[model samples]
Target: MPNLRCCSSSSLSLPAESYIYQLCAAGPASLAAISSDNSLRRFDRSSLALLPDGLVKETHAAGVSSLCAAGDGLLATCGKDGTVKLWDARRAGAVAVFQADKGMPLLSLACNASSHSIVAGTELVKPDAFVLFWDTRSPGKTCRQYVESHNDDVTEIQFHPSRPSVLLSGSTDGLVNIYDTTVPEEEDALVQVVKHSSIHHAGFMQDKAVYALSHDEMFSIHPVTSADEDDSHADEVKAVEFGDVRPVLKAEYVVQVLVDAAGSYVASGRTSDRSLSLTPLVHTPEFHFEQSNSWMLPGAHGEEVVRSVLFDSESRTVYTCGEDGHVRLWKEEPASSAELSSIRPTKQRKEKGYKPY
Candidate 1:
């Protein structure tokens, strides 16, 4: 057990058994633990007991910044060392490592729904934020890099649940861009860049400036992979957004929803109390994370905020990580449709002369 530094009412000191900053739930009873020492360990979710993975020391240079597990024994990790590495978790060895260009730190990573491809977002100190796409079939090889859209640091990247080629990314510049991998040269064809009014035109509102706003909104959608369109040559592919939209205090909390395998429910984490929020998989432009009502979890690293969140589709569990070095899991009782209906405030009821008959 490692000592964790926490503040006490009387004083600040390191305590025994400090929590790690990273966590991934491989199954209902299992989780992968990434310690500050750059070692990877698997633990039992119920008991938090370490499993016998034997300290995988592959990421020696940089602490693991991000991790994703592909359905079939595949695990991918990104490091501050400006590198992305793929590993065979079942074999416990490094499969391949890919390096990024100079001056960009690998900020976020995601594996396609098929788990055949991987994509990463990088921080841009010089020109603009960019994303790198990798064909994981060939590990340790070069990946296709794209930098055509973002003007700021790329903060979040998520692959569409059903469309392996479709990807969505959010950035500090307050822009969301969707990409299609099927396009030979994606820079040419794709959805128009979506910009939020509150974020892109934030300067116009002086009174609500302190309210955090949607400048750091993270996005998740239930993507439609393929459907016959009116044009015989083209297939209809789109993403449906649901749930509440939130104004996150930190830029990383912009988008956190995870679509269920059945395409029914979308699960997301709220920073306020670290509560798990669930929403339907319908087109809900009104579903925003209302800052005033949401719960925020305690900061993991001193005052450092949450950097990433993941979900287990099978168990319907949410795991979150932050700078505080604590990985917390949130589980809520499934809500019935009747319960959800009651929670929604009625517009007619809000009217001045509405009377309950």
Candidate 2:
């Protein structure tokens, strides 16, 4: 790993109590962010500065729960308001809105440009949770729904990197379900199911393996394949369980996985000394933990929990945002270790009632 130092940061413009939980690469030039303040903001990817007139003060009625890039400079955001909005990065207002039936609160969202569909997972409303899908071309029409798959709140949903018809959903019920979207029936749509913990973040890895990270830091990777694509696959694939990474990395929490062409990297953090590291999982002949190439961020978001991390392979830079309402940029230091110049965070507010939810 190259020696990294904090390079740039956006001004603390968010509500001081807000937590910046989501980040999306809006396009080549900009990145979009959503916080607990129920707003959407954009930053210049190069400078890490908030763009002028790039603030959407009210992107959602309730807390903006998630944000995802919808290809071609468009951004999508979901909320506790049970709605999702699409925006063009150049504009400050949302261009279109999609709502869940009976306004079910949505916690996770995914977009498939290849399939021309938007998928959002809802919090468990009563006895059941749902994954709702909307055709981008028909905003006013009702969405196709997938019910009876997960028993608890659906926390994450993502489209297959190569096959858009294959979608994955993870939930608080300790299950990750892969669905074939072309099938309309709920039972028929369900393809593969992997038992896991209460999933905090789960999705496809570069090696076509499925990774499930639980809220309590339990992490595991499982091989996945659709029946039609590979019917000879095992009925129940075993996982390479890396349980409770907090102890393994000496971290207070595991943020999220950032997967790029290089490999799949897990972003883990320790708040005690305010450190973060992106350690790649080597998946060639088999999965292996590689600590030698672990990229370390010495003062990640100070004592705040890092909610989102982004690595740009082309520029070789890393971006992070946290509960402290700060978005920071990091890059390799050019000078010797003695000449390192990572900036210190500003004095934080009293933690009387702060929570890293």
Winning candidate number (lDDT): 2
- Predictions in order: lDDT: 0.48, 0.80
Model 1 misplaced stretches (Cα beyond 4 Å) = 1-22, 27-29, 33-37, 57-60, 113-115, 197-255, 261-324, 328-357
Off by more than 4 A, model 2: 231-238, 336-356
Return the TM-score for each candidate structure. Answer: 0.62, 0.91
Q: How accurate is candidate 1 locally (lDDT)?
A: 0.48
Query: Residue 5 of model 1: what lDDT?
Result: 20
Measured by TM-score, how close is model 2 to the native structure? 0.91
Error of 1 at 164 (Å): 0.9
Poorest 10 consecutive residues of model 1 by lDDT?
201-210
Cα lDDT tens digits for candidate 2, 189-242? 898898988888899874357899898888998888675766443334446888
